[model samples]
Target: MSTVIEIDRLSKSYVVPVRGAGVRASIVSLVKRKTRTVEAVKEISLSVEAGEVVGFLGPNGAGKTTTLKMLSGLLHPTGGTASVLGFEPWKRNNDFLRQITLVMGQRNQLIWDIPVIDSFDRNRVIYRLTREEYRERLDELVELLELGELLSKPVRNLSLGERMKCEVAAALLHHPRILFLDEPTLGLDVSMQRRLRTFVEQYNKRTGATVLLTSHYMADVEALCPRVVVIHHGELLFDGKLADLVRKFSAQKTLVLELEESQEDLSRFGQVVSQEGSRATLRVPKQDTAEVTARILRELKVQDLNVADPPIDEIIDQVFSRGMA
Candidate 1:
């Protein structure tokens, strides 16, 4: 596959004034301003292939959003080189802008007090889409998004979930070749979040658009993206499959046992994580998982037992902690 996104030694920094809290420092700062340089993104490089869906993950204060902004042509990078769809993103050329679409959850592009379809029509004009192309794409998206009735209602009158659905449709009307989704499922109900994830998967398959999705919700990453790029302190940490990340940093597995009765001691098997009614959970070392499972089944009246790897969230937390440490 061709390289849709290529970043080389990309970096960004900011200069801000700093001063003491008290009156003396405040007065001194007025005369002699003290400024400090803050590095929001350090030199980081990665290549994304065409039609690939990759997750961009990082803790708060990391450079996830900053890197995305630079890629989407929304912000100028302080240093380094980057390109998307064979065009320099920071240049903000019309040809480049027409091929890329960015959807930010907190920021709305649709006008209030207008029907959702009208907003979509406005986007059609902005993208200079022909009438037939606009109609075809609109009908396809509305059916896939199940926005038949919602499109007729005013955007201001619709619920948050409804409005977000419209926002996604508006962004896709131009059929952008690349998609930058920053927390697209933020603040949505669980069902709505799942629905959006499904929509992303379908859109990618149907359009073959390269996508870089940054979401705090693991469900979104697990369902849509097989590869992930993790950043911390404005630096790259891991760039690979999610399972590889968990296996590399996580040294323990969880063992869940269904006991025949409650109040039975199972600490001898492993470190008990939780116990409720007839179920008990234990954490055991990866190498000793098989031995511990055998011992539990051999030594106790176990109704059922299962062994699984650590949760993705726990593995990611460890990745950040170790990287920051």
Candidate 2:
């Protein structure tokens, strides 16, 4: 596959005013302005090939949104370079804008009072899609997103999930080759989230569009993105397969043991995380899990035992905590 998105040492920063409390400080800040530069993205570099789906993962304030904004030409970068389909994103060129679509979870670009199809039509005009092409794309989206019944209804009457479906359809009306989805499944229930994931997977498979998605939900990343790039504290921490991230960040495995008696202290074997009645959970180093489990089974009259990887959320927490430390 050809390279579709290339980011080289891309960085973004904002000079924010630091205002002190009380009247005198506020007055002083207005004139002189105590400002601090917050680095949102710090020399991050990555590349995406055509027809690839990559997940951009980070915690709140981790610069994920800032990076996406820069990619979509919503914000200018402070340093480094980015090229999407050989066009600089900050230039906001019509050719660059027309080949890419950005959907922010919290921000809706649809007209609330208008019908969903009308909003899509508005995008058709904006993208200058030919009538036949527009109709063909619209029909496909309607069928895929199940938007037939909801298209005629005003956006305000639709539920949040319903509106989101329309929002995605609107963004894709032009059939952009690249899609940037930031928390696309935000505020959605489990079934709706799954449905949206399925739709995204299908769309990518059918159109071979390159996608960059940022989501808080691990399930979303796991389901839709085989490759993940993780950023924290304005810096790139890990960029690889999700399984590799877990393997690298998580040095310990969780062992759940069902004991014949609840009186034994298992802290000697490892860090006992939780214990309830006859069931206890312990975090043991990966290398020691096998030895510890064997010892526990022989000595503690263990009824049942299971070993598993640490949750992705915990691994992420560890990564960020270490970064902070």
Candidate 3:
């Protein structure tokens, strides 16, 4: 597949003013302001292939939003180059703009007082879609998102999930070749989150559009993105398959055991993560899990035991925590 997005040594920085503490210092600063530079996105480089769903993962203030803004032409880079769909994103050319769409979770593009279908119609006009094409796409989106009941309702009246579906449908009206989704599933209930994920998967499969998504929700990353690029402290930490990340970051597996007695101390067996009455969870080194399990079985009256990988959340927490330390 061809490279749909290319970023080389991309970096973005912001100059924020510094305020002095005392009145005299504040007056001096006002006269000759002191500004500090924050490197929002350090020299980072990555690419996305056409028809690929790539997840961009990071903690807050980790440059995920800054990088997304740069890629979508909302903000220009301080250095380096980026090309999306064979055109420069910063230029914001008409053709390039028409071929791409950005959906931010906390931001709304729909008219607040107007009905959602009215907003969709407005997008049809903005994209200059033909009547036939507009109707066909609208019908498809309405059916796919189950927006028939919500379309006629004003955007303000709709629930968060309802409004999000409308927002996504609005972005897809023009059938853009590239989609930039920033925290698209934020603040949603589990069922709603799953619905949105299913819709995204279906949309990608049907349209074959290239998608770059940045989200804090691990579930979103695991379900939608086979490949992920992890960034921390304005640096690219990992870029590979999700499974590879799990294997690399998680050096140990979790063992949950149900003990026949409630008083046995299992801390000596491994790192005891949690204990409640007769049940206990331990983190054992991957290499010594077998030997440790055998020992536990022989030494204690083990009623039931199960071994599994550590939670992805814990692994990611360890990665960032260790990096900061």
* Alpha-carbon TM-score of each model against the true structure: 0.96, 0.92, 0.95
lDDT of 2 by residue, 271-324 (tens): 999999999999999999889988987788988899999888888878888873
Runs in model 2 lying further than 4 Å from the true structure: 258-268, 275-279, 300-304
Q: Return the lDDT, model 2, position 251.
A: 90
Full candidate order by TM-score, most accurate first = 1, 3, 2
lDDT for every model? 0.91, 0.92, 0.93
CA lDDT of 153 in candidate 2? 98
Candidate 2 overall lDDT versus native: 0.92
Clashes of 2: 0
lDDT: the better of candidates 1 and 3: 3
Instruction: Give the runs in model 1 whose Cα sits over 4 Å from its true position.
Output: none
Query: What TM-score does candidate 2 reach?
Result: 0.92
Best candidate per TM-score, number? 1
Residues 1-325, candidate 1: write the lDDT tens digits: 8999999999999999999899999999999999999999999999999999999888888888999999999999998999899999988999999999999998899989988888998999999999999999999999999999998898899899988999999999999999999999999999999999999999999999999999898888988999999889899888999888778888899999898878988888889999998999999999999999888888888999888987888888887887743
* lDDT computed for candidate 1: 0.91
lDDT of 2 at 263: 76
* Deviation (Å) of 253 in candidate 2: 0.4
